[model samples]
Target: MVSSFSLFISLILLSLAKGIQGATFTVVNRCQSTIWPGILANAGSQPLDSTGFELPSGETRTFQAPPSWSGRFWGRTGCQFDPSTNQGTCLTGDCGSNQIECNGQNAKPPATLAEFTVAPAGGQDYYDVSLVDGYNLPIVVEPMGGSGGTCSSTGCVTDLNRRCPSELRVGSGAACNSACEAFGTPEYCCSGEFGSPDTCKPSRYSEMFKSACPRAYSYAYDDASSTFTCSGADYMITFCPSSTSQKSANVGPLSISATTGSDNGPTESGDGPLGINTSWLPNFVTGSSSSPIPSSSSWTWPFMIASAYLLFSSF
Candidate 1:
C-alpha cells in the first residue's frame, strides 16, 4: 500500500511539473492624449487651448479592445484634434485662434490606457503588450504640448543640414498669417490672427520668443531656445506581463530626436500634409523590442500551445 501511494504521488508531481499549463499573455494600454471627446476647434488662440482639452494638464486618453470583439485589435484611427471648423458643425469648441468643429457628437474618445491579457483567458503569463497610436504617429503616442517645440518659431534649428534656407518662402496659398515659422523650415506657424501675412522673427529672437504664444510656431532646441537646445518629448508608455512572473511597466518617457522638426517632415507617399507618415508606428520603438507581447514567458512551448489552443477554440 505504501509503495503504491508513493508511485501515485510521484506521478502526480511529474504531471503537475510537465503537463501543468502556464500562460504567456499580453496586456496593452495604448494610452494617449490625442483622443478628446469633443472637437477641439481653434482653441489654439485661447489660454484654454493651453490649459483646456486642447492641451489639458495631465489629461490622457486610451484605446482598447471592446468586450464583444476578438481578433487582431486596433483603434484610434486617424486620431486627430482638429483646430478648425466650418458652418453647420454641431460639436464646436476652440483650441485657440481656431474653432473646434465636428460633424457628430457621438465621437468616442480612445480607450483608456489599459493592460488586457493577450495570451489566454485566466492566465497571468501575459504577452508584452503596449498601446500605440494608429500608424504609430508620435503625436498620437506622445502628443505635442500646447507649447510644443514643433509649433514654436524663433527656436533653434539644431541640424543646420536639415534647415531650409534662412530666406525660404511660401506661396499665397499658405498666406503670411499662416506662413511657416522662420524658426523651422518655412512651414505654417500657428498664428494669433488668421488670414494675414506672418513672418518669422529674425534669427536674433528665435530663442527668446519661442513658446510665448501657446499656438505659435517655433524651433526646437536641445537646451534653451537662445541656446538652440531642448529636451526630448515625453512618450505615453504602458506595458504588461507575458507571464504571471512578469511585472507591468508603464512610462511616459520624453524621446528627443537628434533634432526637432522631424514632425514636419514631408509625407513618404502622398502630398496630404506637411508632416511625416507617423500614423502607423511611433518613433520611440525605433530600436526597442517590437514584439506584440511584453513578457518573457512567451518562449515556453507548453504555454504557447495552450494559449493558441484556447484562443483558437474560442473562435
Candidate 2:
C-alpha cells in the first residue's frame, strides 16, 4: 500500500512537469554577417532568456518561452555599444534602450518583426512575420514538430530591402521603410479617417509588400492571410535565409544546436549584418503617407485530497 501511494505521487509529479514545459525558439542567423536579435515581451507577459543577443553569421541559438508567452523579435544592424556604460545604437531596428538588452522596449520603425502569442490552454499558437514596420532582412518561421491544425511555415522570403522604393529607403540601403513610416498620412497609417478595415484599403505600396510575401503582414489591417496558427510546437526563426550565400560567400555550412538560457545580451561585431559587400541595387516604387503603427485553468487541492483518500481507502 505504501508503494502504491509513492507510485501515485510520482505519477502526479511527472504529469505536472510535462504540463509546465514551455515552447522553445531556435533563432538562426543565416546572413553573411552578424545580427543582434532583440526581443520584447508584451505587457504583463513573462520574460524569456534574454531581451537581446548577438548571433554570428551561420550560427544558431535556442531559447525557451513559457506557455501563453507573447512577444516580438527583430534584428538590429550597424550596432556599436559600450560595455561600461551599457549605451549604444544601431542604424536599423534600434530600440533606443542605451544598452545591449532591449529591457522591455520595442524596436523603432522601418524594421522587420516576428510576433508570437503561444496559448497554454491547448489552443493554437498564433504567429506571423510582419513587414508592416518595413523590411531589413528576409525571415522565415518554421515549425519543428507539432501535431494537429495547420502548422504551416510563414515568412518574408523575398529580399525587399534591395527592391524598396527610393522614397522609402533608409540608411545606405540597409533597410526599407514602410509607407506609414515614410509618410505619416492617415491613408498610409490607417488613422483618423482610415482607421478601420472598411475605411482603410490596401495602397499600392502595401500591395508591393504583399506581392513579394503573401504569407506576411504587409499592412496594419492585414490579418486574414498574415496570421498563422499552430499547437504544441517549437519554432525556428531564420534571418537572411534567402541571401545567405549572396553576402557571405566563404561562410561555412549552417550549424544548429539547442542552448540553455544565458545572460549575455546582444552586441555588435566589426561588420554589420546589413552591410553586405554587394553591388548597389536599384529602387522599386513610390508611395504617399505618414505616421504611426492568454487563457487559464482551474484545479482544487481539496478535491485532490478527497480523491487520494478515496483511492487509498479502496486499497
Candidate whose TM-score is highest: 2
- Residue 42 of model 1: what lDDT? 23
**Please, what is the TM-score per model?**
0.19, 0.73
Please count the clashing residue pairs in each candidate, in the order shown: 71, 7
Candidate 1: stretches off by over 4 Å:
1-55, 64-305, 308-315
lDDT of 2 at 28: 83
Tens digit of lDDT per residue, candidate 1, span 170-206?
A: 2211111111333323323323442223332322222
lDDT of all predictions: 0.24, 0.71
How would you encode candidate 2's per-residue C-alpha lDDT over 210-230 as one tens digit per residue?
655667898899898789887
- Which stretches of model 2 miss by more than 4 angstroms? 1-19, 244-315
Residue 221 shift from truth in candidate 2, angstroms: 1.2
- lDDT score, candidate 1: 0.24
Give the per-residue Cα lDDT of candidate 1 at 172. 17
